[model samples]
Target: MHGKTLTFLLLLISIACLDLLLTHCGRSDHKQKLQKQDTVLLTKHWESPIPHQEIPEGLTSISAASCGTCHAEIYKEWQQSTHAVAFQDPQFQAELKKDNIITCLNCHTPLQNQQEFIVRGFINGDYKTPWKEVNPHFDKSLQLESITCATCHVRDGQVIGALGSDRAPHKTLKDPGFLSEKLCLGCHNVVDEASPQLVCTFETGDEWNANWAKREGKNCISCHMPSTERPLFPGMSKRAGHFHHFPASGIPKFKDREAGRLESMEFTESPVHPGYSPGDLLNYQLKIKNSFAGHNVPTGDPERFFLIRYQWMDASGNILKEEVHRIGEEWQWHPVAKKISDNNLKPKEERVYPFTQLLDRAGTYRFRVEVTKHRMTEENARYNQILGEYPLSIEVYSKQYEIAVE
Candidate 1:
């Protein structure tokens, strides 16, 4: 009788375990279904149409301006970044001289009709003259600010925010780190695999998403769009909890030349008087490497500048001659008070250029190049002082040149 009871009890316990397993499986399926429904709903909303608008005259495209319609403050701040000026940068224009295509505009500059933007030379194309209607240009609107809202937050074709998110915007964080940091990698970690040749030399997002940067706990927005004080606006009662500036790598030479950051420098020599007599031709080479940087070298606004000063001097320490080799030119956003250029060599990159000039007078001469770092703002200028001068560096490159009197 006891044995019979033990068998009956075992059967009852087994049945209970089976019932529990079935319940757990059912809940798992329900959760997955909810997730799928959420994804589908998001897609439907993001794909919803905005009234078609005409492409601005001579302009190839125009984004929906969805974020601009709501978050005017963020839209304005976004305009201040280099991402906004991705296309209009003169350096970018110089690059276009190498490879011109519409594919680049599609990613670099957001527009409604990329073809039109290219045709207008508002992007990369055969733009011989300044664009008449530069709306598609970064200087004109805040719409093209580095991919903006429509690119990522509305993933799976779903709006993710109160403004442009495809779904009914969820104000509260359902996922603990969702709004704080996690969702950033979904887009910022992107790379242009379609044309690896034209790939951005400095892919900060790519670097930040890597295991190294991840281990450091550096989130995307922390470095890309850093926080700055701003007046709180409506519709952002929740988002305002964490300021979203999306600080980027690279910055212009700060206004205070002494405050510039020094990474590295280089030098080279070219035929100064290849076939000419002593008073005929003076030639040499100038190279300054962006050996290092606190962030990416060309950080912040697209118009940042880096330049080098070349001087030819006599033994008496008197200035015999001098020329400036601009690594980069004065950008439009911050026009140079003087003619200045930048090498724009990213970290670990090197550039070489030959300098030639006819010598009017011959003397015991020496060549000297000083690297000056300039920033757009005074409080921010450090490219020169931080990198070159602060410690009174004696490692500068110098060479002696002579114009042999015939």
Candidate 2:
């Protein structure tokens, strides 16, 4: 009986050993399959004229100045653009330091990989914290040239664009996607779940897609990066080429140009009397037609807003009575709702503001209407210390009508 029991124990031990060996071999096979898959992906990423090229030796790490050597004209236009100063912009830097939210840097100074930059978070819908370490392979000297030439053109040693076959020192891939809205949407249509409400901080891409731009097949490049007849490369003949300026709503220098795009304010006064007396009520109507902006007037940043302020002023320019009508999204934080109100003028949208003021005193009174653009609201300014300190509020449009009060 003892001998039989000992044989059974040995058999059980042998079975356990066989199971362990099989599991080990299975794991090894699985690991090998994963490694093979990764190798294929890497090969596809580095598919250029020069095979087996290391990332350190690739154009991805090259500075924009290197490209300027061949394409001087295009480079010059890009140098003066907002994209050139995106990371170094005073307002952006101030907000970054004040908020201490390092995640903002992801979009400001994006990764070399366009796909990785676009898909910032994880597949599980979780927000992945960006890597704190600067890439050793990147050109440190060109780090501040935010949204640099490499951001859009260079990808794994290949230059991607919408241009035709051209002989360059490096490999070129003519990607039509560069001409489409897809190129801009990657960074512009971000939806952040970190906020109490899922906030679309930059909604230009979404707005363009949903508005007349999409229906009319008008891409972002059509308006923001309009084509100009000029020589792109040193040896190339003059051709229709798009500029890299990427003009949008916020830049102060472009305020006049943007204002000019709006249809002139249509004013209509009720009780068509030539003169007014004390305690008399007068109604004034103003219509602002958004004829130019393919999207909303203040499109990109959520904090951006516009106000149409109507004031009744005396000959001394003292404001006697005033009323402000906002024409942009109004929001508040803490006990956060999606949006407090959104009166922003949409594409081809017309907004009307009617003002009625009672004559307080009999004298020469001037009725003035001014359109002002604000970087952010007072509540947002309070939260963002830098914004409050360097607030960007400018009058974009203004008009006045003098009425003699009897």
Candidate 3:
């Protein structure tokens, strides 16, 4: 009886050992499979240790031309955008001098040889003319264009996924990889993570993500890189996928339009100014009002601003005098600043104010009022919105002119 019991115990121990060994082997095999899946295969273009070519020395360089070849429309949009003129923006240049760390340039400029750490700049804000006011060694080509497909779409020389992906790096797209909105977070959502600011100024991406994600599902590119149906490239005749000029959507409406906007303008001339003479002073006033906006004139980002430009022109269409008023900032021409109040108007609420300017030596003065919106560098710091100018314009030209000399 004792011998049988001992034999049973030994056999059970041997079986347990075998099971442990097999389990270890299985784990080893699984690890190897994961490693293989993670390994990235380089393309034919990346034969050398470095992925890209030397990028021959030239004023504009060859790489930009390559991008321009396929993305003509994108390039055209970029040309009109401030990304194309980032380096040349007088304000950007001023601010760039303040920061020595080249970190901002990393996204602003593209890498040449896939050598991750090198920072570059546009050879001086010249999109049309390359390399003339040459700031060489800095990338003159593709870098001038803001964010591109290759910029955010490709990761580590591999096309993992596009911008708005839910799964992180190395996750399978079958499970929903990067999408357009996710791509925007990289640059647009830059934060100091080390500052004690009242409101985080540099967290546009984070703010938008928090606000929009819960309400409805939309990505950054959906609004900014919106698509429109155009004839195929180079006029193929059949309709193909043409991205829209406005690539942003899902923005809250004023009643129902974008960002609760109810702004409009019209021009009308006065009957005539009394006691007017040739080469004498004439006064013209333009009425501009913000009918409806949730917050301030240019809400969300504090840096976004509106300016009223009043131009007085003579009957011959010669601009005689001009005065400008900037909202939320100090301007010499006008002494008023943008007002922030609890009673700020919402959709359907309207406020009218007259923009007035005086012209001397006027002969049938023409009055024009322009509402100019600018996304400047300071605003970019706060809202992470790109630097651009948007204008809502209204003009009134005089039918005939008579200036009386005193």
| Per-candidate clash tally | 56, 0, 30
- 152 Cα displacement, candidate 3 (Å): 2.7
Local distance difference test, each candidate:
0.42, 0.62, 0.40
Order the candidates by TM-score, highest first — what do you get? 2, 3, 1
lDDT of 1 by residue, 1-406 (tens): 5674465455435534644765777765755453343222212111122212343332233343545555567665555544555565444454555444334444454433222332222211122221222234333343334354443333333334423322222221133344544444333334432133333222444434443435656555544445554433554344322333333332331223222123344455554542335556665676555443323345333344555566766666688667765544343223222223444555446677666666666445555656554433332224222333222222234554544434
Off by over 4 Å in 2: 1-61, 98-101, 113-134, 195-200, 253-281, 335-337, 359-361, 387-391
Which digits, one per residue and each the tens of the lDDT, describe model 2 over residues 169-213? 567778887747776776777666443532447787878778877
Full candidate order by lDDT, most accurate first = 2, 1, 3
Q: List RMSD in Å for every model shown.
A: 21.2, 11.3, 19.0
What's the TM-score of each model vs. the native? Answer: 0.37, 0.73, 0.43
Output the TM-score of candidate 3: 0.43
Compared with the true structure, model 2 gives a TM-score of: 0.73
Estimate, for each residue in 86-196, the C-alpha lDDT of model 3 and write its tens digit: 444444444444432233344455444322333221112211111111233444445554344445433343433333334232222221245555554555554431112
Residue 157 local lDDT, model 3: 34
